[model samples]
Target chain A: MKKYIAKRVLNALFVVWLVATVVFFGLRAIPGGPVRTMLGAEATEEAVNRMRAELGLDQPLYVQYAEWMLDLITLDLGQSLTSGEQISVMMASAVPRTLSIALIGVVVGLGIALPTGIISATRKGQRSDYVATVAAFLGLSMPAFFIGILLALVFGVWWGVLPIVGYAPLQEDGIVEWFRRILLPGISVGVPYAAVVMRMTRSSLLEVLDAEYMKTAKAKGVGRTTRLYKHAMQNALIPVVTVAGIQIALVLVGSVTVELVFGIQGIGRLLVDAILDRNYPVTQSVILLVAAIMVFMNLTVDIIYTFLDPRIRYGDEAS
Target chain B: MTMLEIRNLRTEFETQRGTVTAVNGVDLHIDNGEIVGLVGESGSGKSVLAQSVMRLVEDPGEVTADELLFKGEPLLEKSEAEMTAIRGNEISMVFQDPMNSLNPTITVGEQIAETVRLHQDVGESVSLSAEMKRKIIGASKASESWRRAIEMLESVQIPHPESRATDYPHEFSGGMRQRAMIAIALSCEPDLLIADEPTTALDVTIQAQILEELHDILEVFDTSILLITHDLAVVAETCDRVNVMYAGEMVERATARDLFENPQHPYTQALLASTPQVETAVDELKPIPGTVPEPIDIPYACHFAPRCPEAKEECFEVDPAFRRVGSEGHEAACIRREPVDGEVIENE
Candidate 1:
């Protein structure tokens, strides 16, 4: 098990490195350079050269990449070319905001999906199942930003029950207010994700519930509750967990639009701003960080599979 | 004394095609300490009949009977809750496929103990003896149940029951898993044990071992068994009474010896001829011609008339009810009274 985890960690590091390299080269390949964006249309050639040299943009791509990689190795994110602010500081705040929204959105998604999926599977062809199915379809079809706007209109503008825009750090605003601020955006990102999760859970559980073992459980005179939850659900959860792992990326991507709609200054919004102003350091770091997080989540999901099924041991079968 | 009796029991399933009757009006009974074999072809509703006895058929499958009695009490009148209490407590079932019959995630011991815990009200005490009271109290605990689980496993001849109890279903071999399943079914000391093709999935060697284990179970448990199988040899070896089913109805009912020696029904005769005996050096096997009719298209008169070579004109006009043949107890569903000679009558 230790060796398996060690191999996974090594693979994860390689993936993060690949993402960082790709983002670094890809950002530089765009038509407009950071120097042009920083100086604007009025700047002269000499001023452009001076600014380019100062930002190490005049250096060869490999040298610049190597230096940047060295800085990243020591946790130094350098300064943003457009804002002249520490990129590390900007990311420290932005990452937490984005992480909070994604975490809450995933939790909300699972909270809605798990019970409703179980209910729909068990009570198939019933009224409750039909209702949940229709609702899930609606959730799946609508875009995250559209859901955010609708929520803001009903709960913010019309009802005055919640703050419509902006974000608050938990450390500064306390837990209750922090949740209050993040709730709308979280639900907006969560609904579509919940739809995906609900569909997967329902289909996966439906199959497991029909398995021969389930028939054995029923014939054993196991109570309906124990049969469904203990015998069926555990087997069903394996596929659901796989879908949930894939949804971590979806939630992260959805948060980009969700952050813009809710006016939250999260990493997603920072990435958007950095791209608009051509801020190389901030854009590359944010993309790399998101890739790292996705890799880590996948690793966690793989570990969870061993816990759910003892037969699924990594690297043991081949040896 | 009769342990279970079924009168005119019918099981039907509503599929996209139509309501197909799997088990037609069939009457059967099992006496205490008797091993009865329900013998039939693959689609002849033997499993459905066994499941009906336990009321295990789910929705879309309807089970109806004029009288479904257990211990002389009408079971059809019992509520679902009442039936649940009776199931696994008074009666239990072993399914066909041992490979998938157990929950994969659970330890074999836990699965067996669950049946014991569900049926046996472990915490309730009506006795005054200190040891009895202690047992009653300990019954609710996991340790006590697990200990009983090991004992049940040991009863089924599973080697290393103590350590094997902690292992999951996949850890056990095919025959061992079947034994473990039998262990679970017999844990509550049910009065009637339903074995549904219990040895069909096993190899010939493993099948013999399992049959031996079953004999041991009969000796120790003192339970009536309704063994469902298509293998004539299995029935001939194990059963005391045999009910030969054709198209969801009992074609012949007799003692094992009588059924084998003086087979009366034309369908029963064909079944016996087709069976390859060790002593007979037959050049080729005689398989029964034509397949069993689809449930939706079963003949209204005699279901076997299309397949039976000796079927007369009247057999096509009217269904034959089970009537006494030569013996006092032996009965067969055929118009012919005298024993037909072993003639290879070609299919019309």
Candidate 2:
């Protein structure tokens, strides 16, 4: 088991390196350099060339890559080509906002989906099931940005209950203030994600409720709640967890749009602004961070499976 | 004494096509420590009858009986909470598919332990202390249930049972998995065990071994068994009394000896003839001619009339009621079968 985990960690590291390398070179291949974007189109050729030399754009691609790789190894992400602010400093602020949004996306999505799935599946064909089914359709049909705008209008503009724009960093403003601001955008990003997971959970749980094991459990005199929660859920959750992990990665990407709607400066907005300004270090860092998160979540999902089912933990044995 | 009694029990399902009767007015009983066999091909409603006794049929399926008793207690009158207490404590079941019958995520031991803990009193439980190698089970119920799980595994003749108890269901072979299920069902030591084709998925050798072990295991618990199977050979060896089901109805009921020696109903006779006998030539082993009639909106007729060689014109018009055959306590449903003195005949 330890050997398998070791192999997985190494594999994860290799994937991150591959993604970082691809994203780094791909950003550099764009039509114009960060120096040109920084200086303006009407600037003299001498001014543009000098700015390009200062930013190491005059060097060969491999040389620039080698230099960036060294800085990466030493935890130096270099300054933004346009703003000249340290890319690492920017991440200190933006990464937390994105991380909080993603965290709440998971919390709210799973929180709503798990109970809704269980209730609807157990009470199938009832009014409550119909309500949940209709709500899931609405969540799926409306995009996250639209949900964000609607949420902003109700909670922030009309109701005047919460802030509509901007993020409060946890360390700077404390948790209550941070949560109060992140909630609107967080739920907007989460609603669509919850719908996908709820559908997966409902269908998967229904399938599990019909499984032979559940009948066995029932025949053994397990109570209705015990049969649904204990016997049916563990098996049902395997598929839900896998789907949730994938949806969460998509939520991270979807949060970019929500961030724009809410004016929260998360990595989604950071990546967008950096891309338009042609800031290579900031863009590359944002992409690498997102890649790392996806890789980590995948690893986490697989590890959770091993705990849920010993068969995966003892995978080396003959069946 | 009767362990379970079902009188005129009928199970119906409301589907898109209309009401489909699965078990139609079936009458049966299991006496103390008796092993009864219910023999039928697929779609005969033998399984539905078993589920009806336990009230396991859920939405869209309905089980109604004039009299349903377990240990002389009115089963139909019991509330669901009371039924839950009876299930696994008074009546237990082993399903057909061993591979799918168990939860794959849990260890075989935990599955067994859960039932042990759910039904067994902690004060009565004795754990590893019986082995004299490890410390006895703790005061906690969990340790005691775990001990019973290993003991149950060992009783089923699983090798390395101490270790095998910790193994998941997939780790066990088909035969071993069935044995594990048997262990689970027997762990609670209920008064009755409903084993539905428990050994059908196993090889013949493993099948025999499992049935033999089940016989011995249930003997230890003094548990009655309703062995539901399509295998005549298995019924011939293991069951004391036999019930033959044909298309949702009990077509024949007799002692195993009487049923096999002087088979009466045409369906029963046909079933006996279809089974390959060692004394008979290979070509003589004839398959029963027709499939079981589709159960939807079945007409008021002997369900086996279409398949029976001796079915008369009247057989298609009236359903046959149980009538005495050659022996006492032996009954067969057929239009031509002799009615016992004072036994009510359905038509004239």
Candidate 3:
């Protein structure tokens, strides 16, 4: 077990290293230089040279990547070109806001989808199953942005029950107010994820139910509900977990649209702004952060398989 | 009194192409301590009949029986919960493919204990108490459960029950897995055990061992068995009473000795003759010519007439009723058993 855990940890670090290297070099290849974008067209050569040197952009690409990697060990993320502030501080503030929306959305999405999926699979060929399947397909086909706008128009603009667009930090307000501010965007962003999870759960459960063991369980006189939760759902969760892991990256991407639609000033919106202004360091850092998050999420998914299926472990004789 | 009596039981499945009748009007009876073998070819609906006893068929599948009684109680009238009480407690089932019959996630001992806890009235303290719990921990209950499992493992004569008990289904040999499944089914000491092709998935040698184990277990427990199989050799060896099903109908029913020695129905005689015997090196075994009819579009008359060499014009025109042929309880569903011109020829 210790060896298995060690191997997984090593693999995770290797993946993170590969991602960092790609991000460092990949951003440099983008059309314009950060030095030119940072300074306006009328800026002097002296000022531009000073700014580039100060930001370490004048250094060789390999040197910059090595220094950045070393700095990561000391918990330093360098400075943002646009804000002239520490990237860590900007991320510190923005991470919570982005996380708050994504976390709640993921929780709600899973909570709604799990029961819906199980019910649909159990009621296979019934009207309820048909309706759920059709609804999930529709949810998948429809864009989150369109859903977000439709919701905003109806709930925000017309009813005036929710704020049309903007984020209210929990530090500045009560829990209810905090929820009120982020809830709409969170749910709107989660709708698509929930639909995907629901469909996955339904299909997985349906397949598991058809397995021979399930028939054995039924023959043992186990109740339908008990059989579903005890024997079926746990086995079905492997696929759902895989989908959820991939969806985390998709959620991070979708949050950009959600932040723009809801007028929330989050990392996604900040990242978009930095890209538009050609703020190289901030854009590079943000892309690296997203890549890093995805790597970590995939690692988490791999780790979770050991717990979900005893048949699999980190270094069990390769299946 | 009869433990289970099923009469005119029919099961049909609604497939994408059309509705197909799997078990059509199968009548069966099992008295206490009686072992009845249901012998037939594949698609004879042996498993379907077993499943219908528990109402295990799901949506797109339907079962209808004119009379299905369990211990004098009307089984069709019972609620779901009541049926559940009867299942594990009274009539448990052991399936053919042992590797897939058990829950993959759970431990073998726990799976056995779970059935015990579900069916029996053991208090929580008594069931889960330190004394009972310690056995699992000390490897004592593990060994005992292991020993018993292995004994059952040995009952089926599977090698090394001690080591085999700790292993998962994938770890065991096919015959060993079947033995483990038998152990699971017999754990609760159920009144009736429905074994659906218990040896079909096993090799010939292992099949004999499993049959021996089943026979020994039944002898000790006084438990009745409803054995479903396609192999006539197995039935001839293990069964006391036999029912021959053809196209979902019980075409012949008699004592195993009577059925084998003085076969009544033409289908039964044809089936017996078709099997390759140990003594015979017949150049070629006569294969039954026509296929079993498509159940959904089954002819209104005799289902086996199209396959029977002795079939008459009237056989294709009218559905035959089950008729008792002579003094014995040997019953056959054919119209040619009556005396005519000093020979049993046609309808009365």
For candidate 1, write residues B227-308 as lDDT tens digits: 9999999989999999999888888899999999998988888998899988777777788999887787575677888898
Which pairs clash in the backbone of model 1? none
Give one digit per residue, the lDDT tens place, for model 2 in B1-348. Answer: 999888899899999988899988888989999999999999999999998899899889999998899999998898998888778778999999999999997779878887776788954332223321111121232487889999999999999988898788999999999999988898999999999999899899999999898789667999999999999999998999999998899999999999999999889998988998776566776779989987888885899888878878999997788888867878888977866664743422
Clashes found in each candidate (C-alpha, N, C closer than 3 A):
0, 0, 1
Compose the digit string of candidate 2's lDDT tens values, residues A169-231. Answer: 888899999999999888988999999999899999999999998988888877776676667
Order the numbered candidates by DockQ, best leading.
2, 1, 3
Best by lDDT: 2
DockQ comparisons of all candidates to the true complex = 0.39, 0.51, 0.36
Tell me the lDDT of candidate 3. 0.78
Candidate 2 Cα misplacement greater than 4 A, ranges: A314-319, B123-142, B338-348
Error of 1 at A187 (Å): 0.5
Model 1 chain B: weakest 10-residue lDDT segment is B339-348
Give the CA lDDT, 0 to 100, for residue A74 in model 2: 95
lDDT of each candidate versus the true structure: 0.86, 0.86, 0.78
List candidate 3 segments past 4 Å from native. A40-54, A172-174, A316-319, B14-18, B125-168, B324-327, B336-348
Per-prediction interface RMSD in Å: 6.8, 6.5, 4.7
Evaluated with DockQ, which candidate comes out highest?
Answer: 2
Higher-lDDT candidate of 1 and 3: 1
